[model samples]
Target chain A: MMTQFVIRRVLYMIPTLIAVSIVTFLVIQAPPGDYLTTVVARLEAEGQYVDRGQLDALRERYGLDESVWVQYWRWITGIVLHGDFGQSLVYSAPVSDVIQERLGLTILLSVTTLAFVWAVAIPIGMYSAVRRYSVGDYAATFVGFIGLAIPNFLIALILLYVSYRYLGQSVGGLFSPEFVDARWNLGKVLDLLAHLWIPVVIIGTAGTAGMIRVVRANLLDELNRPYVVTARAKGLPERRLLIKYPSRIAASPIVSTVGWLLPSLISAEIIVSVVLSLPTTGPVMLRALESQDMYLAGSFLLVLSVLTVVGTLISDILLARLDPRIRYGRR
Target chain B: MVESPPPLLDVRDLRTHFATDTGMVTAVDGASFSVPRGKTVCVVGESGCGKSVTGRSILRIVDAPGRVVGGSILWDRDGTGDPVDLATLDPGGPDIRKIRGDEIAMVFQEPMTSLSPVHTIGSQIAESVRLHTDLDDDAVRGRVIEVLGQVGMPRPESRYDAYTFQLSGGMRQRAMIAMALVCHPRLLIADEPTTALDVTTQAQILRLMVQLQAEMDMSVLFITHDMGVVAQIADEVVVMYLGTVVETGPTEQIFTDPRHPYTRALLQAIPRFGQRRAGRALSIIPGSVPDPYRRPGGCPFHPRCAQARPGTCDVVEPATVTVAERRDVRCVLAAEEVHS
Candidate 1:
């Protein structure tokens, strides 16, 4: 039954992704002119005569001279058959290669942030809910509120300044200047880990705070449920009782929020990466959109939309696994 | 010759209170009762009369803002070992923990919400069994299946993997009873276990419980507001009014020779076929239970008590009087009325 449901859902993703690609292409083309216009304007601003022949050849080479529908069809077909995402107007490389260069770092940052948020927030939230008005609970709530209120970019900026001022070391980028372009190695990995904390902390603060509130509120509601009382009456140990019933139910809502997490995290990363100077897709996508790098920008948007849909699907499956009411069918 | 064992549970001077933001609300005030081995004691009261609180005090599962302020719940383990005071045991201590589901289990009122929806029936039942015994997985599953079959559940083997949501209300209640009885607890505290079921299902559940009690020889603390249920199942009945046990006696005696005014009103309150006056409305107790925070100074029920006297009943709380062996009433006029 579960396998069939998964297959059905996976099949549904094809049309959803196709529709997303169409809408993304249209929206990316919605703004006036193409990448060549910006290049021509820059050259003209530099007092050079407009290179009409060069512009026409460049446009044809990049398929910018084709209609929007034709361009979309070519781009999508390339993605389907040849695993290409068209050419990047800005980077002069394939869009797929540009994204591939940074996808690893983006996933690493997101996964680490996810791990930090869940590890710290869930426990604190559970404690806050159980203890309620205790000093520890109050302190945690106070810290959570502060975390939620501060913007991620401001947080990134402050951390960068603090590290530079107090520690006398650069906190920018994912590696030191010496290893910035170096090949993969143990030292480079260690350096990457060392620099990963600042961005991770800044991006993770808001999520941790939000998740803490989610778990806290949901747990507090579940604690009063009759099943919890029943579990206690059965003399199940406190911790086991929590894990078996209330916490599991309370985690469902948090799991559903996973669909939105990646999108929000990516959006937040754009601003934070610009401020912190990390070489992730966030700043690249931001610059690509601003410069009308349609293929580059469109590919990034497609990746994001795919992540959103896949995240939602994953959350749905997890929720069904965690809660039988949603899994089997509505009673 | 062995002396007859003491009662299975001896609760004396029980007072459970909730320290609310407004004030301290005394829920169960000076409730004293005992549950004999192999018998059912039904605590009959309205919604706020604190019968449920009394049940929770026995298990030490009262949530925050509520506590057993004064009580001695002497649980006679095996009816031979020294009685352990449940109220005095630490709420989460191992001693009480062992006694809670091992010696005394509880089946709550709402079967729908009582068993967790996420867990399978076998797992939930096995939890109680596993906590009380050193049973391995196979042993626990076997015990769960046995108890499920004993509770008359259909297809016990297949039902083992079924979640609570899949079970109907009646089946869920049966599953709850099965979970409570998996360990063969010495005392089962069923707080209105059948109130949420249909009439026919309620009869079936009550019958199942009685059969299981006889087989296991365990005492039962049945809490309910329905006197009809009390009459059907209770070997002894404890009638509570405004958090106080106004009268307690054998089920027949409480029904036939109720002494306290509250008890009389409660018996009269039950609508009997062919007994009502044709033109008159059904009899209802004039007033509701008073707010717990602002309990009347004297007899808490005096404001609504028909037998209340002007200065005496309104100004002074009544003292409990022993009318006969194992029979008691909390009323100022009991002695005068009994003598007359």
Candidate 2:
């Protein structure tokens, strides 16, 4: 039964990705003119006489002269058949290469941030719920409210300044200048770890705070449930009773929302990444869109859409595993 | 008849209060009763009368903002050992933890919500067994299955892995009963265990509980508002009003010779079979249970009691007056009978 459900869900993602790709292609193309226009306009602004012949040649070279349907067809087929995302007009390189350069760091940052969020949120949420209205609960709530109210970029700026002023060290980017383009080594990895905290903390603050509230509210609801009382009556130690029952039940909502996290890996915290000077895909995607680098921008969005679909599938599977009610499709 | 065994659990002047935002609301106030060994005692009351809280106080399982403020839950585990005052033990301490499921276990009213939805029936039942016994995994599973079968769960072996939501209401209650009974507790406090089931299911569950009480030789403190259910399963009946036990006696005596005005009113309120006539409203107590925060100064039931005397019942609380063997009633009229 489980395998069948998973198989059906996987099959459904095909048409979903196709629909998402088409929408992505059209939206990227919907803006006025093409990447060539932006390039020509820039060259003209630089006071260079751009002849119409050179402009037409450049347009034809990049397949910009093709109809929208033909261009979309070519791009989609290339991605399907060759695992190619086409050449990025802005970088003068393949869109795949541009993304690949940052993909590892982006995934690392996102996974670490998610790990930090869950590790910090679940315990504090459980504490706040089990010891509800106590001193610690109040303090956690106050801090959580502040975290939720402040934007991530502002948090990034504050951390940067704090490190510079108090710690007497500049904490920005995923690596120090000495290791920015250094070859992979233990020293560079260590430096990466040292600088990783700032971005992870800033980006994770809002999510951790939000998740704490989610867990606290969900746990609080579950704690008051008769099952919890029943467990207590069974002489299960308080901590075990909490973790084994309400906490597990409370985690369902968190697992169900994990689908949103995948796309957020590349698109979320754009301003924070820019502020911290981190080498992540958010800034790259932003620049691609601004420069009307259609291939690069479209590829970024297509990957994000695909991640969203796959993320939803992953979350559904996880939820099914976590909750038998969902696994058996019973009410 | 065989002489009644010594009481398995004797509760004395139990006062459990909840510290709500407004003020301390005493849910169970100076209520007293006893559950004799191997018999069923039903605590009958309207909502907010603190029958459930009284049961929780005995088990020391009252939730946050609520606590057993003053009570002596004397648990005589084997009818030979000196009774231990459960109220004196720290609710979170190890001694109480050992006693909670090992010697005294409780089943809650909402079978739908009382069993963890994420856990399988066998695992939940096995939890208590594993906690109180040194049983291996296989033995624990064996004990759980045995209790599940005892509770009349259909095909206990196949149903072990079923989640609570997969079971019918009756089946879930049986699972709950199995969980409580897995430890072979001396006292089983069931707080309205069948109130949420359909009438047919309720009858089945009641019958099952009664049979289990006999087979396990365990005392049951059953809390419910259903007087009909009291008639069906109760050996002794304790009628409570606004956190106080107003009457206590054998079920037949409480039904036929109710002393307290509130108990009389409650018995009158029960709809008898073939007694309903078209166009006539079913019998009911005159007023709802009084708000706990704003309890009446004198007798809590004075505002609702049919025979309440303005000067006496409204000015002074009645004391428990023993008018017959092993029967007690708290009423000014009953007090007058004793004095006269």
lDDT of each: 0.88, 0.86
Candidate 2 runs further than 4 Å off: A35-66, B1-5, B274-281
Q: What is the TM-score of chain B in candidate 2?
A: 0.96
Per residue, candidate 1 scores C-alpha lDDT tens digits across A1-331 of 5776677778888899899989998887787887677677777887989878988887775588788788788778888888888767678788888898688899789878888889999999999998899999999999999999999988988898899999998998989999999999999999999999899899999999989998999999999899999889888888888887899989999999888998888788888889988999999998898888877888889889989999889988888788877767742
- The whole-model C-alpha lDDT of candidate 1 against the native structure comes to 0.88
- Candidate 2 total steric clashes: 0
Against the native complex, each candidate's DockQ, computed on alpha carbons, is 0.81, 0.81
True-vs-predicted CA distance for residue A95, candidate 2, Å: 1.7
Relative to the true structure, candidate 2 reaches a TM of 0.95
TM-score of each: 0.96, 0.95
lDDT of 2: 0.86
Per DockQ, the best of the predicted structures is: 1
Candidate 1 all-Cα RMSD: 2.1
